[model samples]
Target: MTQSTIAAPGRAGSRGRSLIGLAAFVILVDVASATASSVTLPQIDGWYAGLEKPWFNPPDWLFGPVWTVLYGMMAVAGWLVWRDRGLAGARGPLLLFGLQLGLNILWSLIFFGMQQPGLAFAEISALWIAVAATMVAFWRVRPLAGWLFVPYLLWVSYAAVLNASVWLLNA
Candidate 1:
């Protein structure tokens, strides 16, 4: 084989590794956000335990597992879109994703950290719209990537309702 031929496989391998690294980096951001949000879990336990939740309020244990799955899916969805479009190509959708994720982190801080369910409800309302917009943008770029966001959207919808309920109950 010519030198160029020999170099082709090496290049492909490097690209594959780069993509994997990028995916990992995306997942790491989610994990870090989750970890930071979890810092209030202990205090949240005490506060939440005292609250008069609505009849539909889920058990506290359910959130951890549910969010773990959702975050995993979120990272994969964003990574898929990023892989397809790169940063420059997919700037809008990815920006929406980041905004929603930021809102997600903020919700935890507001409800759990600051113990303000009412404000968290308002923030989550915006987050719900941002998630939908991100999903639509992802759909336009890559259908599968958009489909991956379905569960996340559904959960956030449910969470939004829950947040509203909590706000109302405590108000």
Candidate 2:
């Protein structure tokens, strides 16, 4: 085989390793956010019950697993884009990704820690917008990366509607 072709796998492997590093960074950020924004069970239960949740809203039991999966997918999607495009190539998407993730954690803090679903609703609106922008940017570089975020976007959209409903009902 030619030198060029032989070098391809090495290049790809290097890209994969870099993607894994990016994924690790994203995971660490997520874990730190979760820890910083955490509310205990009693606190969550009290705040949640006080809110006027919509009948269509999922039960409390659903959030943990759903968010876990979504978070995993989110990391994978970001990694894919980073792999294909690298940091410089995917700067736009990466920025949007970080912005949305920040908003995501802030929503938990507002709703649970601060006991303010109303403000959480507003924050989540920005999160949704950021997610959309991120998806668009990812699409330009890695379509699969953008696609991987679809489930996360859909779930967040549903949660946004639920947040609005709770805020309105309790108002």
Candidate 3:
């Protein structure tokens, strides 16, 4: 006779807890990325003061809180995709997500830390491309996850124009 094995209730509960832990890790990554960028803030502020900003540029106060919320949402979207698809399914999207995040970090370093507005503008343009590719990859697996990136894309689009403007005016 063939015997079937069943998962124990305790084991199932443990599995559920682990899944929650994984989701939390996604959130932590998001937080960590932002923290890394913000750690170099004094340098950014000093460089920013020298720039001739367009009148339409957003006030400095708005950036921190807006990014905080956006990063949280980004984390939730990643968690959702990870939960829906096992790690194997999530691999492609996650890779693209990571690429965009890296590009995001590079933008801050080039624009603010290095005080190179022109190069920063070029970097942000590349960031937009990475973000678009990431969004497309995420959409293929999870439509909602793709949708979650829309606000981020829009904000970055604005940022690109702002970067270009800064580069031009400062030049």
Candidate 4:
């Protein structure tokens, strides 16, 4: 067999390994954001428990499971985009994903950590826009990836209204 033909399988194997590594990297980033946001958990029973939440506010226990699923979906969405088009090829979408992720973490910090619902409402508003932009960008790259973000977008849309209500009630 020619040298080029002999190297084909090896290249394919190497590519597969690289893709796995990228998936791991993407998951790790999401995990890090989750961890950072978890820092406010201790405050929930204290500050958050005292807040005048709207009737629509979900039980505190529900948020953990819901966020876990959302974060998983986000990681997969990002990985799918990267897998379909490598980092360089999908830079714009990836950047949008990263921006929304950062904003996601910041919302937790501002709302729960600092106990500032008003400021968090503003931040989450920006986050809502970012998520929408990211979803559209991801759709352009991979339709499935974009679809994965739909639940997240809906959740955040609800959260934004919840935030506004909380701010208004408490203000």
Best-performing candidate as measured by lDDT = 4
lDDT of 2 at 152: 85
For all the candidates, what are their Cα RMSDs to the real structure? 4.6, 4.3, 5.0, 4.4
- Model 4 residue 70 CA deviation (Å) reads 0.4
Q: Model 4, 1-171: lDDT tens per residue? A: 444323332333356645675677567666756665686688878987888989999998998788878888888888777666666667899899889988888898899888899999999999999999999999998899999999999999999999999899989
**Each candidate: what lDDT?**
0.78, 0.76, 0.74, 0.82
Write down the TM-score for model 4. 0.86
Q: List model 3 lDDT by residue over 1-171, tens digit each.
A: 111111221223346744675667466666656655674578646768767899989888888787877787677667666655645557888788788887888888777777888998888989899888888887887798888888889999999999898899989
Instruction: Please estimate how well model 2 matches the true structure, expressed as its whole-model Cα lDDT.
Output: 0.76
Order the candidate numbers by TM-score, best to worst. Answer: 4, 1, 2, 3
Q: Which candidate, 2 or 3, would have the higher lDDT against the true structure?
A: 2
- Model 2: runs farther than 4 Å from truth? 1-16, 22-26, 40-42
True lDDT of residue 50, candidate 1: 88
Higher-ranked by TM-score: 1 or 2: 1
Candidate 2 residue pairs that clash: none
Q: List the residue pairs that clash in candidate 4.
A: none
Which residue pairs does candidate 3 place in steric collision? none
Which sections of candidate 3 miss by over 4 Å? 1-28
Mind giving the per-residue lDDT tens digits that candidate 1 earns over 1-171?
444323332233357655674677467666656664675587665988888878988888888788777787778777777666666667899899888888788888888888898888888889889999999999998898789889999998998888888788889
Task: Name the runs in model 4 displaced over 4 angstroms.
Answer: 1-15
